[model samples]
Target: MNPTRSTFGLIFFTKKANENGECRIYSRITINGKSVDLSTKRIVDKILWNSAKGMARGTSKESLEVNDYLEQFRSGVVDAYQEAIIQQKPLTPENIRNAFLGQDEAAHPFQDLFNYHNEHEKQVLAKGTMKNYYTTQDYILQFLKKSKKPAEWDISQLSYKFIADFELFLRTFKKKDDPQPLNNNGVMKHLERFKKMINMAVTIEWLDKDPFVKHKLKFNSKERGYLSEEELALVETKELKTDKLMYVRDLFLFGCYTGLSYIDAINLTANNLMIGIDKEHWLITQRQKSAKPVKLPLLPVAAELITKHRHDPRAISNGTIFRPISNQKLNDYLKDLARECGIDKNFSFHLARHTFATTVTLANGVPIETVSKMLGHTKISTTQIYAKVVERKVSEDMQALRSKLSRKTVPDGEMIILK
Candidate 1:
């Protein structure tokens, strides 16, 4: 620690064993009593250190001010030493929440979010989710820097208008590398990430309330156009004829018939297919999006495709039904299939799942609830989005009901019109 510095240290002791090792090491740093790092200390100390140096070089009545600067420097040194003596590990969410319970009501929500995310990234969230959290934090920090505000400013000062304006900023904002503005969905996603971070803050008792409570997240409904039966047949014909691209197309189309997502489909193997309880039907027991195992009856078309690929070399070695292919590459191949099929709309891996829902199941009079279960949707509402595609079937159902309800001159006039 330097007497001219404006920083403190944060050290924690952890037990370690070696041939001749039992000593404490300075693990981290802080300012006052809050967490900081060595880089942050250098940043905070540079100006004050320069000012003290300038005062020391002066030649006037303010010569004694050098002593004052020296005392300030001494205070910083003492704080750093005391901090090291009392330092512990990086603060956890529970530690932060308990701290909040006793502190004055002026702490910044953003700091709370940062602290909570730090702990959660190491302990709870999946690796992919943690990476996204860091991305969201970066976006927010960049926006705040552009606004010329302190990084640790009070979040209570934030308003719904501020959040809305930040979203607008993201849309109109452009980097030198990308001159085009961010799209609506992109901006909404970043803002929603911020909201989720805030929600986490509230969950950890870091904030009294969530500032985003008043804001509604708006996202455009995506139009997922699956292939028609005719289009699917055309693809199948072209795929079965092609050698280089046949396997990819087959696996993708198999997914189309079975309503399997690309990830779940790729991970499926012979082991997943087994005899049902009745032993009359084969079943595919697989985990879908929510990690819930669902048992779907093996349809003939799906079964045939599986049988065809049963002898593939990769399947033999890896014991998985399909060779591993990246989702991006799989989607790229689907674009080729769409081009060959003369279909105009863009298609992707997920379209296979949508195709099974709209074309194979709902179009053939299967109940939406049954389709929802086969699709492994945790909620029926998620599957109901396909109802738009099943409008014709619903119309036919309504017409049939109307005809069945139409009475032919009942015994009493007006068919006794039940109350």
Candidate 2:
């Protein structure tokens, strides 16, 4: 039989009659010419079947009601099916809004970005890195709250203007307890993390574009002030006798001599030193920063310092070789040492590293390339700052050239002829 004319109505027809003494009725539903098998178990099913059958015969008021109900039910099923089938597809605006308003699983926009970073960083990075990530997120949440935006706002909505404005917003916004400017570097540091977060988004194809592509990142300025040789001499020669103070001094001087960074020097001991084929003391150690192994020829001065303070049984242990002191306490003692020596500059333990890089190496005419290796700088440009000290060498060479060019042509009162 032909289906009903109504667009939304269901039509039912017999499938086949059984071979029993009573003819068996077969029921099938047709809606808009498409067939659906109908089960006659429930009252709702029976009513729907009867309405479809009635419509097939002639459209009735009751059949129209059934058609309306069928249309609604069919729509609900189709929607549920679409959601199930297209679960992996990129979300449309309507889908996201429905999820947000309906408080469904699709509500969280940043969920993917968050999950990705959590897995990526949780394994490879350190505890400190994880801590920083949360801190950065805290600021982001604060910004979202102030802007009345969803916590899971679209990652792509982070436009250039939005980010620049947020930076300005951070500069003025104060915490409840304090009325002070937010640390600019702290803000930038966190925002830098956002760049990384979005980079991951780009990799996963979540974001079509990068927001940080053209943005110029402001780098935190380095504290470049370092102690001079005379200042170091004053710190060393001035008498200071507390066991801890003495240890700090010796450690600082050792760094200055060997160009070992604080952590590298901390790890060095009798084991790191080896007598090489040239019969000179050499240090074979891996740099703490880059983990690159380096073979350094120890200077006579470095050897002398080591011999003078050969790791005492009290100080040396199975762990680090140098006398261990907290960075805070070491810096404090160095500050006091600096004051006693009448040196006005701030005296951090790292200045010892700077002193080595600048005064000890450059002043002694050791090539910057060699100094860079000793200082364990991964880039030559990093070592080029000391190139400024070599300007005097250029001046001296020019002076010698000038002297040669101006030398009198006559020697022993005899005129010299040009060749």
Candidate 1 weakest lDDT stretch, 10 residues:
37-46
Alpha-carbon runs more than 4 Å astray in model 1: 1-134, 150-158, 175-180, 239-244, 278-288, 391-395, 398-419
Candidate 2 lDDT by residue in tens digits, 79-174 = 542463357432333332233224343233665577779888787665546778877777777877788888778664556887887787778788
80-160 per-residue lDDT for model 1 (tens digits)? 354433564233222332232333643665666677677865575544456667777777778788888789865645667
Report the poorest 10 consecutive residues by lDDT, candidate 2. 1-10
Whole-model lDDT values for every prediction: 0.65, 0.63
Instruction: Give the C-alpha miss distance for residue 63 in model 1, angstroms.
Output: 58
Indicate the TM-score of model 1.
0.64
Candidate topping TM-score: 1
In Å, residue 36's CA in model 1 sits off its true spot by 25
Tell me the TM-score of each prediction against the true structure. 0.64, 0.61
Model 2 earns a TM-score of 0.61
